[model samples]
Target: MKRRKAIRNIVLFSLGTGIIYSCKDKYEAIKQLHLKHLIIDTKQLDILDDLSRLIVPLQNIPELADHTALPFIMNMVEHVFEEKDRQAFMKGYQSWDQEILSIKGRAFSAMKIEEKQQLLSEVNEESLKASQELYTVFNTVKEKSIQYLTTSEYYQRKVNYYQMAPGKFKGDVLLVDLKNKNDE
Candidate 1:
């Protein structure tokens, strides 16, 4: 009986692990397909990389590039943006790409980190010149990119940091304190 139970537990655990890995691989494949279809412009891709790194700055956590934030951002840009916003994004993307080409005749991704940072700084300055609503579009994209990359369960497991004391919620301390204070 003990041997049978142990065998059943092992089978269940193996099946669960297999399903989880399969789902992860499928999600990755879908993400890759989405990125491939979008063919995101070089400038937008560069901006996305910068934004992702900014939000999830390298520390104990891995860099955003190690995740798929850039492709995720591109997918969002392709589907979720309104037509006008999309056009605006394309314009900004092209202009940034052209600037890089004129400076180094290479894509922004190929540039050195310092050069990329400088270019992004310039792009940010240009974005600021736009109207508030227009500027907000880019900001929205940046925020969503970070949120999806960092918190999505498919990419990273969500951790609950809250530690609750046992029987703490049912304790009468709060009521007693309130009653005493009222009497006083």
Candidate 2:
């Protein structure tokens, strides 16, 4: 009887352990994404996510909570980017936080928003001595962020609101002013 109970307990424990391990494995697999040409691990994706959040700044505004540039940027990087851009992106992505660590003595996860912003600004201003790849990554990310933001539904509707009106609303002295300006 005691042997039977011991065996049962062992079986239950083994099953539980297997279940837990399987779940953990599945979660880990889901965490890191495998792109066709580029592999963006969870950590790298998080950094990009944080950067996107920094650029668009959706946290402050309630309406923009649903809008994000990260996904769009990722898709573009996966599909639209050329081989050279992809190589530069990978090199930059790898060295990006490392440069931050060298300069700030901390990783992106440890820094505040302002600190991150300052670091990126340094990259833009050519203040930080980063590699060409780093600069490429910076430029690409910035350009894509703006592109995504401008093309986003929220930007189209609220931020970039334009009224549809029919035609030429020139000033009173339009033709004369144009002729005089050209003459000058």
Candidate 3:
């Protein structure tokens, strides 16, 4: 009887241990970034993702679940930007959020859209002039995100329609106001 009880206890203990060990850690480190030139890590990418969502042109959308321009911006930084610029941008980004936190008393991820916009409005060159890092990070993300939004397929299709040809037709033009010296 005692042996049976001991066996049962051991089994239950092993099962509990297995369950606890198998469960995923809530604070698991994010996956590492795989950029050729830029050296951003997972945490920085997450921060950049948040920043990208804020700086993008589409403020009307409620949930930008996966519409971040991170890939495009990262690609631009990796390919188009020179080594010096990339380094400067990254150097600024590493601690840029602290400036906003100081003013808003909340993390960028925690702030609402309006709060973010207000904080960003205050991050101009004059405000961040004391720290080039803060300015660099804010400016880089803002400029690149806007560029991505304006040139994106959705923006082109929905917001800014492309014009294949420059001329337009007017159906109700009056001949009396014609500026032509000779009627053609």
The top-ranked prediction according to lDDT is 2
Clashing pairs in 1: none
lDDT of 3 by residue, 1-184 (tens): 9999997897686545321122343213221223555555445666776676666645455443335667767777767898888888877666656655675578765778787777676775355333676677777888998887777666665455545573986587666644341232
Cα shift from native, residue 71, model 3 (Å): 0.8
Q: Once superposed on the true structure, which residue ranges of model 2 sit more than 4 Å away at CA? A: 1-34, 162-184
TM of each candidate vs. truth: 0.45, 0.64, 0.57
State the lDDT of candidate 2 residue by residue for 63-177, as single tens digits. Answer: 6645556666766877788988888887777677777788679987678889989887787788988689878877777788888767666767665543367276556767778
Q: What's the TM for model 1?
A: 0.45
Residue range with the least summed lDDT across 10 consecutive positions in model 1: 17-26
State how far residue 154 of model 3 sits from its true place (Å). 2.7
Clashing pairs in 3: none
Model 3: which ten-residue window has the lowest total lDDT?
Answer: 18-27
Which sections of candidate 3 miss by over 4 Å?
A: 1-33, 57-66, 98-117, 128-130, 163-184
lDDT of 1 by residue, 130-173 (tens): 34443443565566766765565534532422234534453456
Candidate 2 clashes between residue pairs 3 or more apart in a chain or in different chains: none
